[model samples]
Each structure stands twice: as structure tokens, then as C-alpha cells.
Target: MQAKEELQTHARSSPAVFGYPRGRDRRGLRFVISVSLQLDSQGCLRRLQSTGHAVGPQGGNTVCAAATALMRSASRALADHSSIVISGHAPREGVLEIEVLQCGAEYHAYLRGVTDVLLRGLKDLALDEPSEVTIRQS
Candidate 1:
């Protein structure tokens, strides 16, 4: 119960999906530090999203669905060699303002899994498209 509450707290306090707030600047540099891994877990990750103030009832559910989709896609592409599990807090202005962490022992496998999906994701993104994906806006 305590863990569940903490999860809810984090979700509630997290920034919106990816939209420029009224007072915040959109063109800002983000802080991120990443390390290479050889035995990482396989999975896809998404930033915690925020739009208005509340994360809403489906916030967690939506994130879970996205994670599952990414993992399934990546896993199928790579067979059973590796898998990915991603988690992060969405930013207020940028698409995803956070350092990506690759968890698990098969770090290398995880890295490849993430990379495979990332390349595909980048291809799917367009420069003109806004990063914001909020409940209200969606």
C-alpha cells in the first residue's frame, strides 16, 4: 500500500506529457548523463507525463500500455535474447527531459533492444510535431 501511494505521489508531482507551459521556455537545454552497458535488460521507456496538474486515473495505465508495446515490439524483433523496461518522468516542455537508464543484468542486450526501438521511434518522429501528449490535448 505504501509503495502504491508513493507511485501515485510521483505520478501526481511529475510534469506534463510534453508541452510548453504558459510561463516556461520551450527552447531549453536538458541535463542528462548516460552510461553504456553490455548486460542490460530489454525494454522501452517513456517519461512521466503531465498536462494540467493531476496525472488522472488512466495516467499510470497509459504509461503501462506504452511500455508493454515497446517491449513487445523490441522483444519480438530480437527474439528471446534480450528485453527492455523503461521508466521516466515526462518534461513540461521537451519530448522527454531525462537521462535514460538501462536496468537489468544483461546490460548489453538491453542496450541493443533500446537502440533498436529508439531508431525506429526517431524515424517515426517529425520535426514539426509537438512533443506534448496530454490527456486534455489528446
Candidate 2:
């Protein structure tokens, strides 16, 4: 089956997992940010999209900074893999969309780890803001 078809099937069968959660923390702070990731068969990351603004009295700069760093790091890591096709866009404020197509086998582990780390960091950031991040099999 094709990648798109596989994703559709996976989506239908599996429930979406939380990359981050939408609810209140122990401190009773409610969060509203969310990030969702979809991985294709063979364990390759296919897409990552995030929405919601950074919260805090500090401003949105920190969230933007984190997002920028994550994107840069991911981009650089994938740079050596000519087989992978990556596309990203940050249109409007507090929105990020990144997609990776045709990830080669040799770089699969590295790319997956990179995304995992990025999500972990985003989770940490979500503690203060309303952040939710999730990874799902495609």
C-alpha cells in the first residue's frame, strides 16, 4: 500500500496519543498548545505540525526561539540525507508545519531521535504554556 493509504488506515485504527495534553496542570494552570506528529511505516517521521502561542508574562519570543531552534536542528540533521524531502512553513503567528517525505533507512534512527528530542523539549515548555504534543503511527 502507498504511504498515504497506510496513514489513513492507521489513523482510523489507532487513537491519537498525546504529545502534550490539553488540560490543567498540578498547579491548576490550563494550557492550550498542541503539536501532532505522524510517522509512516518503517518508522520514518512523515509530518509534524504545531499550533498555539507561547504563554507567559515574558512574551512569545521564548516559544518562537524554541521552535526556531528545533526546526534548525532538525533541518541540519536531515541535510546530509539527500533522499529525504522536507518542507516547512511558519505562516501566521504561533503555527509551524514541517513534513519529511521519503526518509532513507540509514537516517531513520537519527531522524526519529531528533524528533523525539524536539518533542521532549516542547513538552517541557508546555508545562508553563498550554502545550500538547503527540506522536502517531501513519
Stretches of model 1 off by over 4 angstroms after superposition:
1-87, 93-95, 127-138
* Backbone steric clashes in candidate 1, count: 24
lDDT by residue (1-138, candidate 1, tens digit) is 999997767554423433434423244422111112122133333222222221223335344335334434543434334333444444442233222343455555555555556444432321222232222110
Error of model 1, residue 118, in angstroms: 2.0
lDDT of 2 by residue, 3-106 (tens): 87865453322112312345432333333346676766645557877665433322424554675577557766775678666888877555678888667767
Report lDDT (CA) for all predictions.
0.36, 0.57
Give me the displacement of residue 131 in model 1, in angstroms.
14
Model 1 TM-score? 0.26
